[model samples]
Target: MSYRFVTPIPKRAATGSVAAVYSASARELGALFAPHLSPAPDLHAALWAVLRESMLAGTAPRARKEAVAAAVAVVNRCPFCVDAHAAMLHATGSHDTADAITRGEAPDPLVAWARSTRSAAPDPWPFPAAHVPEYVGTALANHFINRMVDALRPGSLLPGGVLRAPSRRAAGLALARTVRRTITPGESLALLEPGAGPAPAWAGDGPVATAWPAFERAARAGGALLGPTARAAVLEAVAGWRGEHPELGGWPGSVLGAVPEDERPGARLALLAALAPYRLTESAVAAWRSSVGPRGDAELVRVLGFGAFTAVSRLADRVAVVA
Candidate 1:
């Protein structure tokens, strides 16, 4: 089945601090996936940019946004996200507040009342009738899942699940796979290389040439905006490399090594994948299937995707509120 994907918006620059933050986030995220597969870093980076753009343009509070994210992770059973968000709460000195809520404890009167309201647990000992909207709870659940997705499978943020989701669990697994692939053996070596220079002739000239454009096109279709110069350079570099290495089927560590450190992470990789010429590589496809294998429920996958979307929407809203 052909999957629908969002193309990157054609723009000159990312432009704002939030946008830059999002880009950096994408890069870091991509680094997480670089080791496992050929296309993961690119996918992760592209999704990060798309989600950040959406959030910066929306109206939500960051704290509430994080709470919602926490809720989703709890429901999804994603330990990584739960621990990470809990740490975030702790850093903000809200550990007591969050922990109280999570453990079903007898919190101090004032805090207990608030936790009861937030968790929507029926009042055991009533003080005042405090009502929490069903939607609020729903939003929290959704937010949690979305954040997990953002952290784990940024690529799935693209409009359609074309490259990633064959089913809901498959989608989640696809995201997990993307995360796995972002960190690779070559990143350290790439970082140690002298002055950020263009890729070696052997690195560029090969099957990488054909694959790069396909990847780039996918990224553009998925909402990553690339400047003219950046786009042109990528195209030229990939083309030259493809001409040199006709046997290459997947991207090499050196290709990433060649990228300037500033541009070498998730966002750049996503941009490269979106603009490259190949479909999800065989390794990526296989890994995605394996990751989601244990959780066979498609509904869970849909919930995860929807949760991610909601979290991002909320984050966008919060950023707007402060701006």
Candidate 2:
């Protein structure tokens, strides 16, 4: 559970040559998730790896995924996720689309119903339990969300109404979301924490610091990041940090400042350093950073901070999910 720092080598100039970075990163991540993998030996670890791979593959166009993710985040009352997804949606095209989504505008009748279901409004008519289970509301919301997510696949969403088949990655992320929902915040935190067992060493300070600001900018630009389960894990980490160090209460600014500059390697190594304490290896931390991109790294940190506050809020009997 102690911290150690690792140095980072600048990635090759060729943007296309992401293989080296990705491979190195995946190795480290694999180590971080090792403990969780140990108990189930088959189910948990296998599924986790598969999901991680799917995320890396970018199976669907970023825009579609963002749209659905944003919708789900909104309905779930998770501001962090909403903001993050909205940013992603904006990145793909126009600010107008992002704005409309955040404001709850539906482009068509189907979309309207989708929005309503996402908000958990009652169905227009009653149906048999077999057709609509007790959790019909949640299931409907998820279905609509899945539809949006599925639209991410190439040709799935076209101007004139062409429906392209869904990619494996799109299907995978949806499946991952479902599985992730089954895991409670406490359980995930336990899996991610350092004491669970030996994990990859921390990469360095550069990535951590670099990522913090990036996440902040992304959240400010859009709103939130990470789905419910991942968001909860972030909050749990932040709360744990605060409980041990009361002075670092707020997120981004306060939390970023908590780590001594001298102890930090550099902005490029910040993420590695930040994760080092958690026993992540250099390669693993690097991969996480690479997967997030500079902006993603920053946004993730901000989300994590918000997540921590969320956990605290819940403990105090406040709202469980932030709107």
Candidate 3:
């Protein structure tokens, strides 16, 4: 698939760490997300590591987490992920549930909770406390993926922008074998250097506990491209968000008023990706590119991806506190 911001590293062209991660990820999941991430190789590996540990390796039923992924995609308005994960949810043998999710319906309590993750906290905490790591990880993964896909890829997964029922069902059938395959935890961690951050209180000692910090660290590297003032502006804006989706308007434009004229483009792009991605515009990206002399696709993806992930990470922290 052609991407908007970055050229995907084709499988045949992948080398070194990117090659290893692409091979393992394709064998385990599929090629959709990893290719889009290949421009930033460490971010690619770190995210795959998080998904492997949280979704693929968990003892909790993968089907439930798949459901959560789809539901979160729905809330985020990321059609690419909603369709992709709905197919994966179908591969888990929850055919009716997957179909319902594709129609924008929450088929169960777990899915309902996932849908509400951005807007509302779960009061009494649902599900077995033991399943927190897997569930939260899955939601966080989709939250990040949804924003990236929205910013980078087309809304549909297949060629010609097709995403009808028949095509979705066929995609599910193709993924069934891999979705049902057994995977070992922490396998993808080999791609990352070990870090010292302790697991968050919500994630016990599971592989996800380690994987999330790694993903966050790699993602945060994008902030290096942002001026300190720009970075602080984006974070402060995200902090003021009430979890409700922001209405499209002058706010994304005005929020960056404090940013220097030269830095506003990048800062604006980051803020939109984090709080209101659907509001992103062609002019917004063009502005950033016009200002950046030599910083190309990798830098663009980093700046936007960092913003998106930071928002979701904060949401995960909120979920942890409520739980």
Candidate 4:
């Protein structure tokens, strides 16, 4: 329950643009979400820039976009994410919809569609079949982000209905308006980094795979944000990963446990990101945030988020392969 699990960097200590977003997030979501943003400054900028752009990137309306996001949050049972996106949905004038959703009431069409993706036997999807890539991408992205939130951190912006309130929802819209200008889809998909694995075979040669390059770049780019020291530590931990233990959901057991001593918090964080998120504990969070360890929070979040992102998205890939 304690935010102390991950230590927040002081405003002065937070790096360049990450400091800017931290200030904005504090203004919008309260100080609660700061720790998630402050550690991995570089990753914060690169990953989010592309993701935020993607949120409004294609023709997806804010309504459908937020609906997909809210549904994903509900599916993941991430209280914070559900409220945040539901508010965004409300601000778009889907008041009854958002309110009902957060309270666990009338389900939206998009919500049903989002749920259908999980079905072993999917029905004819009712929405625009052409929007599949964008819709599925948003849902999958939230799948990754949700796991990271539920796993690595704690706390939300508001206590309860406050987050879903009309005024609060308007504020969320305002924040989105402001925050949107700051984000830029960076060169997320340039070329593979040293330690990054290419898009897995399960992704297949389909719409998701076509777009997979960008996501893969964005996912791997966050790891690049880690400073030389922290980056090395994390890579070491991932390399040392024995992959024997299965936590949250297990990852490829044959590939992990590659880090060394120095006990760099980033290394532990990376290992958890790659292999076991359910294994994340307050003690582990605190150790990474330790003064002696890595310097930034955004970098940490990006690396950790990317790890969870890759893990969760693997479900879609495997499902695609089966189909």
Which lDDT values do the candidates have, in the order given? 0.32, 0.30, 0.81, 0.54
Tens-place lDDT per residue, model 3, 1-323, is 67776788888898976898878877888653458788888888888888878887888898888898888888888877878887887777888998898778977788888887887565345788888888888888888888888887756764334436667778888888998788988788778868737778877887888877888888888988888889999988888776887766668767878889888888988988897776777888899888877777788889988899879877876777766
Clashes of each: 62, 38, 0, 22
Question: Lowest-lDDT window of 10 residues in candidate 1?
Answer: 1-10
Q: Output the number of the lDDT-best candidate.
A: 3
TM-score of each: 0.28, 0.26, 0.94, 0.59
The prediction achieving the highest TM-score against the true structure is 3
Better of 1 and 2 by TM-score: 1
Give the alpha carbon lDDT tens digit for every residue of 1-323 in model 1.
01212222112333332234334444533222211111223333333322222211123333343344444444433444444444434434455644543344534443333233223232232221111221122233233333333333344222233421123223333334322322221221211213323321212232222222232232233222223333344444443431121234545334445554433332232322322212224453333334434422222222223223332333223322220
- Taking all chains together, the TM-score of candidate 3 against the true structure is 0.94
Q: lDDT for model 4, please.
A: 0.54
Could you tell which candidate, 1 or 3, scores higher by TM-score?
A: 3
Candidate 3, which segments miss by more than 4 Å at Cα? 158-163
- After superposing all C-alphas onto the true structure, candidate 2 shows an RMSD in angstroms of 16.8
Give model 2's TM-score versus the native structure: 0.26
lDDT of candidate 1 at residue 245, scale 0 to 100: 17
* Native-to-model Cα distance after best TM-score fit, residue 102 in candidate 2, in Å: 1.5
